[model samples]
Target: MPLVNIDIIEGVFSAEQKQIMIKKVTDTMVSIEGENLRGVTWVKINEVKQGDWGIGGQTLTANDVKAMAQG
Candidate 1:
């Protein structure tokens, strides 16, 4: 079995976006590994609290990511 784990800041993406991510990631994995593995491939999206993720010694929040996207 293959597992694809995705971590993102909480509230950064909507439920629909998360579903799309899971589907697309699974499809990509199956395309590379083979159809037989499609059923066994797992894509998990884990969400961390907005202030729990850190980078460069600073805690990151969903707003930080959204701001980065805008610029």
Candidate 2:
């Protein structure tokens, strides 16, 4: 069985977007491993606290990551 885990800070994602992400990730795993779809297990989404995460010695909020990526 293939196990998948996705971790992200709390935020709003449309249901359709979540489903699509799951589908694409699972499908990619299936193609790579040649495993049955039914054998795959997707773990629940994990939300990390902003204060608990850091980048470059500074606590990184969700907005910080976005802003840095855009620059």
Candidate 3:
């Protein structure tokens, strides 16, 4: 079994986007691990609350991420 965990700031992604991410990640794993492991592959998305995730000594929120994406 292959397990993949993805962590992202809450509100940074829509529900549909998250689902797409899971599917894509699973597909990538299956491609590398073989079709036999598809059933045992696991992909999880973890959300970190806004203002609770920090990088470069500054807390980041969904808006901050959005701004970065825009740039």
Please report the candidate that would top TM-score against the real structure: 3
lDDT, residue 66, model 1: 91
Q: Model 3, poorest ten-residue lDDT window?
A: 30-39
lDDT by residue (1-71, candidate 2, tens digit) is: 76787776544345676677778887788888776664655635566887677767888777776676689
Tens digit of lDDT per residue, candidate 1, span 1-71? Answer: 99999999998999999999999999999999999999999999999998899999999999999999899
Clash totals for all models, in order?
0, 0, 0
Model 2 misplacement above 4 A = 12-16
Candidate 3 Cα outliers beyond 4 Å, as residue runs: none
Pairwise lDDT winner, candidates 2 and 3: 3
Candidate 1's displacement at residue 67, Å, is 0.8
For the record, the alpha-carbon RMSD of candidate 1 to the native fold, in angstroms, is 0.7
What TM-score would candidate 2 get against the native? 0.68
The candidate scoring highest on lDDT is: 3
Query: So what's the TM-score on candidate 1?
Result: 0.94
**How do all models score by TM-score?**
0.94, 0.68, 0.97
Give the runs in model 1 whose Cα sits over 4 Å from its true position.
Answer: none
